[model samples]
Target: MKKTGLFYGVNTKKTAQIGKQIQEAFGTDQVDIVPIEEAWKTDFEHYDNLIVGASTWFDGELPTYWDELIPELVSLDLSGKKVAIFGLGDQAGYPDNFVDGVGILADAFELAGATLVGFTSTEGYDFNKSRAVRNNQFLGLVLDLENQSDLTAKRIAAWVKQLKKEWAE
Candidate 1:
C-alpha cells in the first residue's frame, strides 16, 4: 500500500476545498491531509506519494506558508518520491500570474529530486501567462475557482485517476 501525504496553503478556502475533494477521491484512509501551517510536523519521508497545493498570491508569489516551507523542502532529499501538485488562481484577476504558485512548488520538489507527476493540458483555460506552464502544459493540476468553479469536480476526478495510473507506473 502506498502512503500519500497532501499539504496545502489556502486563502479563500477554495484551495482547501479542492484539497478535500482530492482527498475524498483518493480515499481518506490513503491520504493524510495537512494544512501548510502544520506541515512542518509532517514526515515527508514516510509517504510513498506526495501532493502539494497552494493558491497563487499577489504577483505570482507562493502562499505565506510556502515561503516558510521552501527552505525545509530544499534541505530534504526527495529522490524517487512520486509528487503531484495543484494550485488555485483567478485567471481573470491575475491573468499574467495564473497558478504560478504551483510552478514554484513543482520547482522546489524537482530540486529536491522528486519525480513530479500530473502534468495537465492547458486547453480550456484562459490565461495570458503562468510560470506553471511548461511545454504548453501545466506542471500540475491548475484550478481557477474564481473563474471556473463548475469544472473543479470533474477536473479533480480526472486528475486523481491520472495520478493513480502514474503512481502505479
Candidate 2:
C-alpha cells in the first residue's frame, strides 16, 4: 500500500474537503491531512508519497501558519519521495503569470528534498479580492481535478494514484 500524506494552506472547509477526498482515494484512513501550520513540519519524510496544497492570499504568500512552517519542511530529507502540488489562486490580471500560492509551496517542497510529480492550477477562480471570499464560501476558479469540488483534493488524489502506478513498475 502507498503511504500518503496531505498538507493544507490553512484551516478552512476547503482543507477539510481536501482531506475527505484523500481518505476516499487512498481507501479509508490510508491518507493523513496535516495543516502545514499544525504539523511538526519534519514528519513529512515519514511518508512514502506526499501531496500538499496551499490557499492563496492577496500577495500570493502562504498563510501565516504555512509561512512559519516552511523552514521546518526545508530541513527534511525527502530525496526520492513522490510529490504532487496544488494551489488556490485568482487571476492577477497582469501578465497572467500568477498561480496563487503554488510557487511558494513548490519551492519549499523542492528544498525539502522531495521530487515533484507535477502540478495544476485552478486558474481564474480567485476570491481574495472580494467580501464574498471573506464570507467563507467557495469560488470555482479552481477544481478538484477529481469529481469532488476541491481542486486541491482532486489533485492530491490524482497524484496518489499516479504514484501507485509508478511503484508497480
Candidate 3:
C-alpha cells in the first residue's frame, strides 16, 4: 500500500503544488517533482510513476526548456514506468496549441519504454475555463493537474481507489 515514485517536468510553481497534492492524496510519502531542466538520467531510473508537467509559451509554442529536456529523456530505459503528462496553456488564446506538449512527452516516454497511467492530456485552465473549473472540468477530459489541494486530493483519492480496482482485476 505504498506509493513509490512520481516526477514532473516543469519548474513552474504549479508543478510543486500538483506534486504535493498527489503525494498527500495517494498517501505516498515518497514523491518528488523534479524540474526537467535540471533532470538527470538517475532521476528517471528511480521513479516508478512519473508525472510530467510543462507550460506553453509564445501563445502555445513549445517551451525550449521541456524540449531541451526531451532529447535527454528518450535515452533512458523506463520499462516498467507509468507516465502522466500535464500541460499549461491558454486554450482560448492558443486553441490549436492545447495539449500539444502532451504528445511530445507521450512519444518520448514511449520511446524510452514507459506505459501511461490513468490518462494523458493537457489542462489549460487559466484561459480555457476562466480560472474556475466547475464539476469535473478536466478530470477525464484534459486530465487536470490543477491547484486546489483539497479538491485535487479528493479526485486523486478516487483515482487511487480505481487504480487498485484496475490492478485487482
TM-score of each: 0.95, 0.68, 0.67
Per lDDT, the best of the predicted structures is 1
**RMSD values, in order shown:** 1.4, 7.6, 5.9
In model 1, the clashing pairs are: none
Candidate 3 regions with alpha-carbon error over 4 angstroms: 1-3, 120-169
Alpha-carbon runs more than 4 Å astray in model 2? 92-97, 120-160, 167-169
Error of 3 at 48 (Å): 1.8
**Candidate 3 residues 1-169, lDDT tens each?**
3234555544567655665566676565555656666778888888766666655565444567777777888988999776655555445555555545655666788899987655522242434332212243332213333332334545556655554454334
Among all windows of 10 consecutive residues in model 2, the one with the lowest summed lDDT is 131-140
lDDT, candidate 2, 21-74, per-residue tens: 655776777767766666874568777877776655655566777778777778
TM-score between candidate 2 and the true structure: 0.68
Pairs that collide, model 3:
none
Global CA lDDT computed for model 2: 0.58
